[model samples]
Target: MKKPLLMIVGAIAVLAAAAFLYPNAPSGNAAPPGKDAKHGEKGHDEGHGAEGVVEMTDAKVAAAGIEIVTAAPATLHDSIILNGILQPNQEALVQVTPRFPGVVREIKKRIGDSVEKGELLAKIESNQSLSVYEMRAPFSGTVIDRQISLGEYASEQKPAFVVADISTVWVDLSVYRRDLPRVRLGDAILIDVGDGGDPIKAELSYVSPVGSADTQSALVRAVVANDGMRLRTGLFVSARLILSAKQVPVAVKGSALQTVENRNVVFVRSGEKFEARDVEIGSRDSENIEIVFGVMDGDKYAARNSFVVKAELGKGEASHDH
Candidate 1:
């Protein structure tokens, strides 16, 4: 009887120690070791934020300076990029040189001044006749350069003024021999002015049969209409010649392209919110990119400043300590 009693007291002491040591153990909802990966994946999916969907207010869109453009069918060209410089149309350019050796007496036009054809530009005292004579413009144009000043020595060898009609200009492109075979006299040339302006369209008018001594490239000239004087003489420009033309049924500006969640995407403006939509691209040119799958023609997407949407989406999906 005494032994049984001692055994019961020892059992009671063990139960008391167990209850004190393990008062708050894991419940039924507690996860197992292998279950952690499952929970982590769930959090990841939530944090990824529905792939490309980004929502914001109109005020936020305007404040972010997001620009939107309509995707549409566009005429895309396969082009060969060329480096070149803008020059005055040689047909419209004139060098006004003195006919007789003389001393400059008076000057009227300066560089960048405009004069009409047969307009008086300067007066010179003839060395032979000892009398003053006037120099007139040969063509209506802007004075691009003036090498002579008032009272300076003037002669038949020196040009008094160089004028060029900039209503049109020439884009001289350096074409490699390999490109010569593809380039034609009537091919279209797009000249990039580098001022974020529209490219000036020109047609290849001349291609030198001979190559250059320094670069081994032939000179190819394209005449472009420059009504606004956008193309300036000696201005460095990048150009491309269209080899083939094709219709891109659906296309968007390259600036609209963005990478979201490791997928090619475009921020499509849906009503008041811009949603990031996945895209499958086919072909791309210097300005426009062809859309193969994701987006459709006439769908509006963010063009300039689309990165703002990307930034906002990034902030929304930013990780937090749980």
Candidate 2:
């Protein structure tokens, strides 16, 4: 009887120690973290973690003309800029050559002289025909180069003069391999003729599949009308390759975007507070930029006067620096 009583006392002591170490949980449940203290609400939970949030008074927002726009689906236009040089039209540039081995007996046109179609250019004494015949201009153009002199012997293989029609020209552009996927025939391109004038409009006529041996770039050719002879051969020019419009799910006005701390950000309105939210950007045009990620639809963001948010953020940084 004494041994059984000692064993029961030891069991009671162990139970008392276990209950002291691990107590039972409370009967009622606890509320989750970050919930509203009064009503346990979640309406203000979204976008709470964004940093650089600036709160403005109603008067200040109105005085600054801060307009808020909602992010929505829109169309985006993309473009690529290119560089090129103007060249003489290859189809119109021709070498005036003799049909037979001959000696030039008479010459009419000189370098820089203009000639009309079927106009007499020179007279040659043909060696094969044993007779003198007249050589006339093949087309109405200017004599750009001259190799034959008066009474000079010329052969069928040698050209006497080079003629070219300068009213039209070709713009040969360099399309890199990275840009080749977007470039196509029939695409419209604007050529900056570099004369303090408006850009010339032209259609992309050709693209060589093979890359150039010297530049390792594919050649894109466009034909441009050279009225008043403004576009000359060998003149360097810039090209803007216009792309088609594409609709996207999210886009914003370019005026709303600002760079903050090395990150592209847009100020989103949460109640009276404007939070600068980091964003990822995609294709863009002059007016609108496509947002690839960050910020959701129906989220109001500062459009015009977004610089005011940037200024406020700057003030906060300045204060922290002090």
Candidate 3:
């Protein structure tokens, strides 16, 4: 009887100790020993919850009328950019010089003065070949340069007045030798005057046969009409040369194209994910650009604001590494 009683008392003490140490312990979700209680399973559950919150915020922004465009097949016109200088047409520039040596009796027109054809520019008293010589304007235009004043000596070798017709001006543009084969006479061109206005239209009048030895560039001359006398000679202008007329596939905006690793690329939307794809580019217009390859027609692409997508992709990659 004494042994039985001792065994019962020891059993009761062990049970009481266990209950004090592990009060409120989980029954079915007990963790194994020597293992982390919160590992992949716990992390995945929290990560998915955070992702759900971010998705909801993004959906709200899209519903606010923010414009988004997808890639589509469209026509694009090709163009080439070239540096140009404005100059007076040969037929419009006139130099006033005396036939013989003489003393200038009077100077009529000053610089920046407008004159007409056959208008008198100055009067000179002949000293070498004749007497009382009168200098007249060669054409109707503005006096761009006047080097002689009253009582100044004039000669046949020196110009007294330089006049220019601003109705039509010539723009000398430089084109790369590699592109010279595509450029030809009579091609339409556009000149940006840099005056915050509409560009002037012109046509290619001449193409140089030889390229510059140093720059390896060929000279191309275009004639632009200055109907309103808005364009002035000696003003720096930018020229755009039309290269081809064939219609090729292009994007709606040029900003859609991005440069990656020294190559052109664009982000393509592939079923809730964006993939960066290298592309072959050909031509570009004022607003759109031609896409050569690495994309298919009707493919969904980030037309504008693609930097956001890139940032998200980078974050995901970083998280995976961490």
Candidate 4:
């Protein structure tokens, strides 16, 4: 009986020594605190917290095409938007006519043909003189219309060709009666040809004194130099007539603004991370917006593609929750 008792006491002492050596060892099927079988050293919510911080490396940011810019004073344009269509500069257009009533002998120019000044367009047989007369282009331009076909009559009463030098174009904008009071000649305007390109800048050259009885709108025009022939005649366009410009102390591009967690936020750059900072926005133009709060001058932020940061933050939060 004593031998058996001594053996039980020895067993109890060995178990106590093992427990002291491995005090924090994981129990069966259980992971240690702040760790899991899948999570390894840290739990799912280890790195994220209430204050939103998105960890993005420089390479990741560059790969995402996120442009960073410092908040600074910027001009906010207060402008009126107007829709219009492009037209050829009527002043630079010409109508070519035959000098005498004649029968067409040879037709050379066609619609859409480019012509040089004094270029021969056709040879005509005059009805009275029975002599061949030459029809020449009055100026260098493109033939927008050709009235006579081969062997067709070249009449003196009708134009033989409609040529226009489209080196410059007129943007014909219709101003509603209500907006006409605000628009004036010589005001600065931006012409958008809806080709996803930069808007062309020009001054308003003319404003009609009379309003159209049919549309109750007045015609306003801007002459724009057709650089690269980008402003095609008959293409629909939009214009922003500058009404006023105000300088704000702190402003950012409108693309930087984003709505996150039911609040407006701008992703501000911190070392190796971006924080979704709440912001109050004020006046905004087509390109930029005034930052009234939560951002300060000299703060570097995601000026473009800020939605990428917002998406990353959402993903982080979701992973933390899961």
Candidate 5:
């Protein structure tokens, strides 16, 4: 009876121990503290937390579209840009000055009136010498300025009417000193009169050898045929001198280039990050500039405003060093 009681007591104690330990045991095997199980849980939680933080902050970073280009041997026709005023061709502009002093009796043409060659513009009743002199239009053109009116005094040296031929117009382009080498006598030019139509094409007729000391620009004259009588003198126009050759090296938009440390640089997209690269620059048009070095063809580059990426990169570098 004593032996059986002892065996039963031991069996009960063993059962209680097994029940208590089962709850505390790991699902697979009993792992040591701070070992694989504990460490794996901690790491997984940290990983998830880090990923959440990244996702939360990613919305603030602005993204820009980028383009990949390749460098090829291209002809870069360099040019000088200048501002110029439109003037009538010398052969077409006529200033009518009276030969003798007289009193103007009648005025035939007014401002903005179109006249023909040999057309009588005004009839003057002379009182100084009692001789009547009739003023006629020298060329078929529009009257731009009328200095004399009816019954006004007309002097021999005073201009009476200013006539300008609208059949052919001149575009006086202001070429900067830097672009003087690119301008030639026969280069093609495009002139925009801001009339909401296509630009007019013309050929460069002459380039001034001397530059103006005040504006520091040379005058380049282009002659355009105005058979339709569309262009007018003194109309503010934007001129574009087209070069015969394409830009060499690689060309990118001007907005894409930025200054860093007083040097020109462009952000190149690489994988998930952008790389800052210094570049050599060349001639530039209004919208695009020539890239002399640093970028290769087919390499994706950030376009539009890329300052955000540059700031982010700067922060990243700082953080890495820290």
Candidate 6:
């Protein structure tokens, strides 16, 4: 009986030693590291182990429409925006009038008709001699207004036709009293005519010496080439007057900027990885921004569609939380 009791005691001691040697050991079903079925053996998600980083392949980037641009020296404009309207270049507009009081006998052109230089517009019968004369276009232009019709008495007091060469249009911008001193002739201007088109580039051609007392604004003029006649007369437009421009050593497209965790960040590219780096910004224009810190010259960054990378980083954080 004593020997059997000692044997039971030794068996209990052996079991206790085994438990002590393998303390906190995984269960029989538990798989080793890099062999987990749910995580595909890896502890972290693919391309997402580091914080504030997103990984995307070249094909993925192109498919996402992410435009990558290199940081470089760029000219940033100190600009002021103003509202304006497009007008026909008055210098190129001409008013056609009968030289003498006459009767209109023939009408050859109408409003919106394209005419050439010396193009016959109408025939007028003189009242003084009962003789006929011809009205011709003074230059190549579109007939914007027609004041006379056939079989009507015409006079020299009123214009017979109004023609305008609209190949180049005028942008009349309103300069407020506070901004008048900053505006000057020959300063660069960009006219946004809308319709999702690019802004038309021009130079300040004129600044009115007179200011309207009612509006308290001066009229500033810029002549822009009206290619395709997109800058039609009477259409309101917005303009950016470049008051000053400065070159910075490091700059990136404005589209690359994003706010992350209450801080401004620019996503910099490193092979397949995009790291959100906190950046200090300086002067900024409509297109580009100056990076005072956290980015260097020649650094490649995601320009267009950079928000996609930010979303990806957010996903990583959410998954980590779970």
C-alpha lDDT values of all predictions:
0.85, 0.85, 0.74, 0.90, 0.72, 0.92
In the predicted model 3, the residue pairs found to clash are: 117-140
Q: What number of clashing residue pairs does each candidate have, in the order they appear?
A: 0, 0, 1, 0, 10, 1
- lDDT by residue for model 2 over 117-165, one digit each (tens)? 9999998999988799888889999887889999889987888988889
Model 4 scores worst on lDDT over the 10 consecutive residues at 41-50
Worst 10 residues of 5 by lDDT: 49-58
Kindly provide the TM-score of model 3 when superposed on the true structure, using C-alpha atoms. 0.64
Instruction: Summarize candidate 6's per-residue lDDT along 28-107 as a digit string, tens digits.
Output: 87876556867654655654568888889999999999999999999999999999999989999999999888999999
- TM-score of every model? 0.71, 0.55, 0.64, 0.78, 0.57, 0.79
Q: Please give, for residues 115-134, the per-residue lDDT of candidate 4 as tens digits.
A: 99999999999999999999
Residue-by-residue lDDT tens digits, candidate 5, 1-322: 9999999999999988987978665555756655575644334344222210112122343433334333344455444344567678877788999877788988899989999899999988777667777999988888989899788788878789999876787888888787788678889777877788897878888888799999888888888887667777787788778876564667776776877668788777655545677889887766666887987766666666666656655555444333
lDDT of 3 by residue, 66-94 (tens): 22466666656578888878888878888
> Cα deviation in Å at residue 215, candidate 1?
2.0
Point out where model 1 deviates above 4 Å.
1-52, 150-152, 258-262, 267-278, 303-322
Score residue 25 of candidate 1 by CA lDDT: 54
In the predicted model 5, the residue pairs found to clash are: 69-297, 69-298, 70-297, 70-298, 71-297, 75-246, 76-247, 76-248, 80-179, 82-174
Q: Which has the better TM-score: candidate 3, or candidate 6? A: 6
> Any idea what lDDT model 1 has?
0.85
**Candidate 6 off by > 4 Å:** 1-47, 195-198, 225-231
The list of candidate 3 runs beyond 4 A from truth reads 1-74, 128-131, 245-250, 257-322
For model 3, state the Cα shift of residue 151 in Å: 1.6
Candidate with top TM-score is 6
lDDT of 2: 0.85
How does residue 181 of candidate 1 score in lDDT?
Answer: 87
Better of 1 and 4 by lDDT: 4
